[model samples]
Target: MIQLHEQGAYYFDDQIYLESEKKNDAWFDPEAGKKKTMAYKIMQAHNHSGNDRILELKFDSIASHDITFVGIIQTAKASGIEKFPIPYVLTNCHNSLCAVGGTINADDHFFGLSAAKKYGGTFVPPHVAVIHQYMREMMAGGGKMILGSDSHTRYGALGTMAIGEGGGELVKQLLNKTYDTHYPEIVGVHLTGKPKPGVGPQDVALSIIGKVFANGFVKNRVMEFIGPGIANLSVEFRNGIDVMTTETTCLSSIWATDTQVQDYLTTHCRGNDYKELKPENGAYYDRFITVDLDQMECMIALPFHPSNVFSIRELNENLEDILHETEVRGQALLEGSDVTFTLTDKIRNGRLFAEQGSIAGCAGGTYDNICAAANILSGKSVGNEEFSLSVYPASMPVYQCLMDNGSASALMTAGAIFKTAFCGPCFGGGDTPANNTLSIRHTTRNFIHREGSKPQDGQLSSVALMDARSIAASAVNHGLITAATELLQEEKAIPKYFFNKEIYENRVFQAHDQIQKDLPLRIGPNIAEWPEFNALTDDMLLKVTAVLKDPVTTTDELIPSGDTSSYRSNPIKLSEFTLSRKDPHYVPRAKAIREVELERLAGHDVRQTDEGLAAVYGSIQNHFPDFEYDKAIVGSVIYANKPGDGSAREQAASCQKVLGGYANIAKEYATKRYRSNLINWGILPLITPDEIELKNGDYILLRGVRKSLEEGSNRFEAYLVNEDLQKINLGMEALTADEIQILLAGCLINFNKKEVLV
Candidate 1:
């Protein structure tokens, strides 16, 4: 259903051509030609760089959820930020379950409100709305740019260029600094033909994700949606697809806006924010993805990743073969673990079954998606046979409209429980499935342990992603895996949505331009100050604490989300859980290295603490005669094939930093946000050759590490200080000037502190 063009393409008259007839024409100016793209216009408008190759962006507004906002505010406050320079929205959605951490979640919420009041920002109370939903309703504007702390922060359907990044990026905006980067390549996503009735937006999204994610076709690039098929989908339908683009690892996304988009903003009472956005006739793209929406089928992304997609029809046809392959893959993924992962047990009578069904979060909990789901389950019931269904509307406004229009009643009557607006399930905080069970969800992701199944504790479950329509279809069949098209009936007529703005008026606190200086932040006992970080020394000796051979390691496995989110405000406490899910030994290993650094700082003899390290220091001295063991900072490092796949949570990198991590050596980083998190935390995002072999406990002595960074040397020479100290090459890829300064000063906060002092 989706075709990827490997070469540069041109879009004309709503069609994509890999090589246009007008190519190489004397009249065409490649520099001026780029202006035809909608991304170029939006980015140029926000760009502060005099050169088009570099981008220094200042977003119109910024957003954060409860799990992130507190840390962001703390960093910004420490950096001497007095007030928010731009609109900042803090939504208490992720940490809505205040009881998880014993008043810590609520304390973070109170701190968010107090900070909003003290620093001229906006705060949405718990369950009022999910972060992206609130931004869509009130903050998103046509051609505007928004930076959010959560990864799925995509508002492309509304013609807004929204980027989900690490919390440090948002802190830069709070401090009136710019988000610096090289100009991202633009990829044209040309949609053609109408989607089949049962094929919802998630199906289309998964098809696209399955095509692009594995090859990194659209990674760190802007996905500009343009095509005649854009007119065939509703704004809500477009939104459901757009929000999931984060899974593609794209930097940001934007779409051509039509009357449908105009009407969406108008209905939400923000008509003035609407503006028509379309690519110029001869717009050029670095690459192109042509999606035949008509060919899309009820899709399911099997356990572990959103990109492991297959059509429901194909999967059902080859059930045994597919399940067996998945089981083998699961075995490899969960190798050396205590838990026994199995999916074949779920199959009975040649059909698969799921224990739970969820249609919630930004990608699934839209008014149209829920409305369509309610229609499908109008008279049918989700029979109580170990199968349950729950629906969470995107926002209070959507909830009110669903209730008023009888959609809520239809779902409730069909035994599907209705819930308030919350983002807990999407990140493993709520509605976790029973051990060894399978869940079908319409949420954003289905990564391992993301459903709150602690595999370390012998509790392992799996989640498969599907469209809400298919999820409801499966629910009605009592969790028997079924496609929505199998029992197709007359399409339901969706009522015109009437947005109730009063829901926000009474609940949300808008503190913009109303800064209260005397407001004290309600800090809980769990909330702690950031640990002091030391500046980069002349030389460094980093011991590899953990080595991950996984193809891609997600953030969930790094610091974990779910219940651990409640401890995000406390760096030291949260660091204890770093890599706890993936490698249970990583924390203790990292802590041992941290203790060594502490001992060195206290002027203790290194040989007294760890006798093995004394030999490695002697080996390093043999290579560099001038090298001083006492001057070299001792820290920990981790090597992975490719790390930082999912989530924009800064704690993934910060936790490592808290445990005295100095660098991360990887073949490549999975996402820009993850790499940026490492940079912001003053950890070197080192790039190594794919074939390089390094093991845990191997020490690498980086000579002139600080000097190399300050001098803009991309490559550095290091020796593996083992029994045989051999030379190894290490390098960093594409660090901005600010990033270099951040590293030199230890971290973004320290970098900003030095700036303020200067």
Candidate 2:
């Protein structure tokens, strides 16, 4: 549980936290010298190029979740990549259930397993482990750097610096291309004192998250943990807090190591992994955040987002006012939806009432949290009713530990069903609630549709985030929504844990080739090959198939994954539903356009007959009388202010590219990883600011687009014309030197294809 002051507070001298009227300068710009100094030492470790925004460095390993591995592998395969350049772990946690395209999910798993075997990579079967959890237990090490396809890939808690990037960056790694970035400033997240009993790390983290997330205090900055609290917590606890830092959207994280950390690595059979890391005594920090754990209390993040937080006590004491304020804020964020949600509905019985409870995913499905939940739920029946509770272990090892230590029996005996380590419930993929149901969970995200709802089609389910302890505490009372602190005050109970490593020793396939040969992998048929894409042309005629007016469209809406996850490997089948969920009419409109492009490419003379083709062709012919409609390749593109956010799912980009998508037009991209994926797959990364009028359904013709890209020109002339022949000038965004060449070559594959010619 956690407590937060309305005003910002800072811990000074590791003793007390007081209201700090001063700005957060420790991160913005800290004192010049002394222990309070926050700075960057690693930038000194290597040289970089381009704007300081790009960094080039060597990494210890790379990883990807269910959503990203399929396309990352497909891109690498296109680039003639035969094997992984570094240790790559493909975990099937994101799309564990075969929800879409019949067998698409299973096919992707097969592709992963086969690629792992063929390329000597590591493969984690569906529901075996979440991507982040597996990486922490098996891959993290001191002073090492890792790149993952998922944006939440942060391992700095264990002395490892890991980055969550777009799949294009991962493709570069797979193809032996260097990860480019300007070095980042390291902000010291100085921790002091131990978290009081009954309080969890989530409490401390939410407090920090509340302060930093909204203002982008640490955006694209590295969080380096130091100070005395590092000695108090276990490596797993540190990792849990570190993983959530992704919610803050920071670049990466690293923590100072101690004996508890060393012993944890040693117990995992990685004894030599012990290494203590800290910045030089007076290392500079762009900023400093000193967290005093003693004052922390139990916390809860309300529905919709992890950043919506409040102390249970405050909400209970001032329920009416808080709920009213929350309603106003929700209305503002929801944009005029009849989202009839009111926390004050619980005020009738003088208590909070939650309909569902869940303890799952990388944030909550830990050995200690599960063990603690088992202890709380033991000997107490959850009562057969609508308030159901489910517990999911993060990995087989944690599951085995719970069973071996009698924790699993405790929860099961108490009427709670234990489930596999699937990431489904966290996303909309698994355990969806009925319409209007409100579920409370201890998961990574609680975004819209994250708990399984389709708002566009009129179905809405919501999830509120809580720590695992509180989830069980509420379930014990049949969902009266009691806080964990209240239960602890009534009865004191602390569970002991016994680490069990035998299951991993027996079941986990180590990174050895001999052991890998005997393991058989499964593949299904719904998987399809990636379609061929033409290179950037001297001139391009692009038809805007989809235009999203939603302020922020999540990657989930672009390509609904929870349902279509199973079809990740099959290009044609998956493309059919490109914008089906978001805009039900998108597929037919896209198909109509595709037909004209198809006939034009096939050399059919349909210019005079086809209405859709006649207008588009007539406009192009007026500009360059010699231009041939059949010779000009046509494709679709999606425009949004900012896209490619939330999940690291590559299908969001791949599905569009496969359905004849040639580019993405956006004001800015959400993450570096998503945009890179667009470029690698032969889609143009187009940027047309507010000055350009890019109307939906209009044909924007880019003449010498390929040459401009190859020549590394930032600005190029493009003509925007309707079927009526009216024309206007449009411009393209400047690209990095390498980005331009990749576009001209038709994608990374074509670039590599030219290698054979060399």
Top TM-score: which candidate number?
A: 1
lDDT per residue for candidate 2 within 74-117, as digits (tens), equals: 76776677657689998988777666556566777777877787
The 10 consecutive residues of candidate 1 with the worst lDDT sum are 25-34
Candidate lDDT values, in order: 0.89, 0.70
Task: Give the 10-residue window scoring lowest on summed lDDT in candidate 2.
Answer: 30-39
Q: How many Å off is the CA of 496 in candidate 2?
A: 5.9
TM-score, one value per model: 0.99, 0.86
Candidate 2 clash figure, as a count: 29
